[model samples]
Target: KSKNPPFMQWTDEKIAALAPNDSTERRGRTLASSAKWNTIATNYEAIWGECKGSGSQPYLVQIKLSGPKYKCSCPVRKPPCKHVLGLFFLFAKSSAVFKYQAPTEALKNWLDQQSTSTVSSASKTLAPVLKTEEAIEQAKLAKQKRWAQRVQLMTSGMDELELWLTDLIRQGIANTDIQKASFWNQVAAKMVDAKLPRISTYLKETHLLIQQNQNWSEVVVARLGALYLWAESFKKRNLLSAEMQEELYQSLGKIIKKADILAQHPSSKDLWFVLGKKEGVDIEGRSFRKIWLQGQKTKQQALILDYAFGSMGYEQQYIVGDLLDGALVYYSKAYPQRAIFESFESAKIYEKTTLNTYKDLNSMLTSYGKALVQNPWLFSFPVGLSNLKAFVNDKKELQIKDVKDRIIPLSNLKEAIIWKILAISGGHSVSLFGEWSGLHFEPLSMLTEDGILSFT
Candidate 1:
């Protein structure tokens, strides 16, 4: 049997998952044709290829199987550019095409450099620092000063936002020209300047809802109500619980550094199953990925959110349905869900078995209601229901119906994906997992007797 690692055995779906966006995935697919490569070779440790590109010389592409790291001579700023992806796609299709050979001198040099850098970085990270008592005190005071300044800025921003909402309400939603982009952009820009990016996103989302949905007035009113509630809560934040205070800070776009979270928060170790993922590009042109994981023994759900800017990819890659042994440290929140890996061990295919799912839609909804009571600003909640049937409603929208005949609409899904789910179900009940946005359910994956199929 071959000794290649699990990641070396790449599949089309896996390749697509690594892409930063749909457009990049498409471009990679286009470049996957074997004829585009002048050479394809592999060793136990790495895969190397030379692909024909716009440049005069064939771009040299090398992938270190251990890091699954990519190195391409192409000028593209984005990692795992088309050349690297194309090489992997070709290798996945026919590994026999890649002759086993020693690395070329240039490839050897790149590999050696990567090894050296990895070791040096690890050493620096593991090294401890000695800080004098005075130095520590100075740092603590500086942090407090920074926090006080931020509080002042955020307070002013919230006051301005409250006044804007009041004016908008007085003028009335019907009278407002919501169609104009500036109606939302101007306020969103102000929020950004105040370092309240999360609030800015809410305004932008509200604008999009008005443009896309037919019953937008209700949506807008509900959103505005939430904003008003948050504003009122901020005024009384001093009386809130520590968890609620953290939630408020996050809502105002304050980020707790990963190192701080790892140092301060408790870590839970468990066999975690990669449930599914969602990817999208934000208004700033940065790509974001949300991967949902469920702990097998603890039955706890955690979200791993990662983002990448122009030409960069996410720091980590998670394949749906894989089970990993890891410890996660969750950020402080009223209803903690987002987490980062504190430690990671082995990963393997999740053994198909019974999953912890809600008995029905009512059970899931009740649980969600409780969570909402804890974190009023919760955007989306993960849910899994067993024996749910997928079907299209009269309005040509996809929905999942429970045994009670109660149904919830699936949000923002393509017709093709909807039909695929229907075909998989064959009019029979199937286990479904997804996120519930108070208004609708978005099916991300489905479980079958055979295995789990990802719909993301």
Candidate 2:
């Protein structure tokens, strides 16, 4: 919003990037071609317009060409709205339509406010970094008070869960109606009320697991045991190391602020390879995508997780099989895998480094075991196995045999899928990267001299 000089010209691609999807872009393009405008004006720093929509009056639309901030009179939840998008498309496609003029009064007021706020914020940010001793003490006291409240809530929740588990154990999970959704919902609701929504989610998932499996009692008991361990550990959290404490807080669903993370954590710059990516939606319906990268020099794996809500676009950069030079700020965790880009230097579709792979399944398991020792919360870890031959076993199950002839029966993989990897390998031992559960390896991609073949 600050009136900086126009850094770059707006293009069709840039307009498309602001749009949520191709459909939105198409609609905007169509509207741009036909929409009637009362006034279209622009300066170097911003553009403003009054466009006739399907309404009585024209909608006033203004966009700061610097931050690309949009303000429109239309009542659309999406920033910029369709009207603004149309305006952008018009500006990008043909700018001569806009008259060279000074900004309107409303646009001028907004720009002036933005400039004042930017100057004030700059002055504040340039102030001293350290707080006074008295201020520090007050902040520490407030933090302690908040933590104490959280601990009390968790304790209450744990007590209720302990009693519920006891009742189930005595009644027997087989006797209990695990298929009854209300039964789990009641307990999950209690957990939510106690401010432990993540635990509620775990309980709901456990109910589904019991219903899906034939051995419902075993699954129930095992999950209940894990819950008990978490509860007991929470009671003795003071004895745990700092890293374990951070892990415990994460497991409890405590949110970590991104600002704090970037401020406190160390950053590293390296040439990173885009290994793989996964996309999923959370319970709240927020769409998220996670891209995994491994550094060539540091040999460190970093995860870039991004989120978007309705009508918002995901990140377009960081394509798989590309190498990028960037400084990444890691989140404080036992494994330290998740990170955000602090600074990106350069990126290109280049693949030069050799993929690190284990010689055998035992070696892979050993590495996972070591990682688990440092971070017990890790349920799935990535591994690249070398010299792996894919074949069908006697039971018609797809299996991957390593250099030592040790076979690992693959799960979450079908015949046609294994055939693709086999076809890529041509019966030769190739480097395969995948996630390892305790039972099987879920191959994500296979690396060969030709290129990276994604199986996920």
Candidate 3:
């Protein structure tokens, strides 16, 4: 999907229906074949309505098949989208041809012989668990090997290029250097030859920016982050989560066209802090961290950047939510879709200090205040509607929840839960379990090298 250009006929909306509800735009991508679907009798065709977006063209793509597998690219995340349905409609009537030929008697006979011989030779009588484990191990090994090879090929070339560029900088390319367009053009050409398309594209973009960009440092920083991300992706392709993998691919795709959002300041004058820096870490890919710390008449607040990481031609810096991070982060509304500030260290401020422990208003501001000397303005700020507790009325006043002490910032829900849990444990430590999230509780015991806690 990333390989395809802007003019490519496919769009995100077309991917929706054919995918599972839990499936994401870049996930749940089994892409089963006709034979594969024959085993499960899968595939379904469903349609919703006309397109709804900023576009003017009447674009339509839907599921065209179901039961024997399907394909669609709508935003729904359900499989067998309307396009796949329509495609299969032709298939059901024997009109359209598949990517592969139909099973022939000759081919079937050969396959049968091969299957028989393979089964006999391989000993299919192995225990299911052992067989499954062996298959998984083999798959892991194969994937590791493939990623290793790709990383080896891409990184070495990029490293050489980075060093070469650094040398040019040392020799002062700004003053005098090679003038031939063929110099960089040839480098870009070599990247394609090496199959390092990401690096190749980066070189081409950098050359263009140097030749045409009004702001070179900003462009360089943004592209540098993306190139670093692609290199990191090559390094850890086997370990990336589906969401992270999708993000890596998305960043790589935008390396040629996007800008670094970290350098772009919002119109509002607010103190933003660095919660996480992707330049030094691999988890957030090629992004950086900046948290907006706004202030009210009485206290300060934090609004996560949850970087609107889409479409803007720049480097994006994402912020963290108060409560979600690490494993539990996988479960939430915007879930799997998280920003940089969402890191544990960046978002959490759980202190065993005291109730309303903030000494003064200035001290209460986020770490951003010390550097920017501004505040998180509550009166006129870009607040999100997702926070149910912070919903605004027609009069523009915050709706207060009876359960909360005063009108709590909607962003404090998750943070409040963590504080509540900490209060219960008196900030020592507590073992979390299914019961904590509402489940039948039973006696439990936890042990560490220092001590043990037993529930009776």
Per TM-score, the best of the predicted structures is: 1
Tell me the spans in candidate 1 whose CA falls farther than 4 Å from its real position: 1-9, 21-46, 49-60, 64-67, 73-75, 97-131, 166-179, 343-350, 353-355
- The digit string of per-residue lDDT tens for model 3 on 178-235 reads 2455666677676666556656656665666555444455555555455554555546
What 10-residue stretch in candidate 3 is worst by lDDT?
Answer: 434-443
- With a 3 Å backbone cut-off (N, CA, C), the pairs that clash in candidate 1 are 78-311
What's the true lDDT of residue 144 in model 1? 98
**TM-score ranking, high to low:** 1, 2, 3
TM agreement with the true structure for every prediction: 0.83, 0.66, 0.27
Between candidates 2 and 3, which one is better according to TM-score?
Answer: 2
Superpose all Cα atoms of candidate 3 onto the true structure and report the RMSD in Å to 1 decimal: 22.0
Whole-structure CA lDDT of model 2: 0.73
Q: What are the lDDT scores of the predictions, listed in order? A: 0.78, 0.73, 0.33
Best candidate according to lDDT: 1
Candidate 1 on 26-136: residue-level lDDT in tens? 787776777888888887678888888786899988887644577788877766687788887777777777778888787888888765553212113445679999999
Error of 3 at 365 (Å): 15
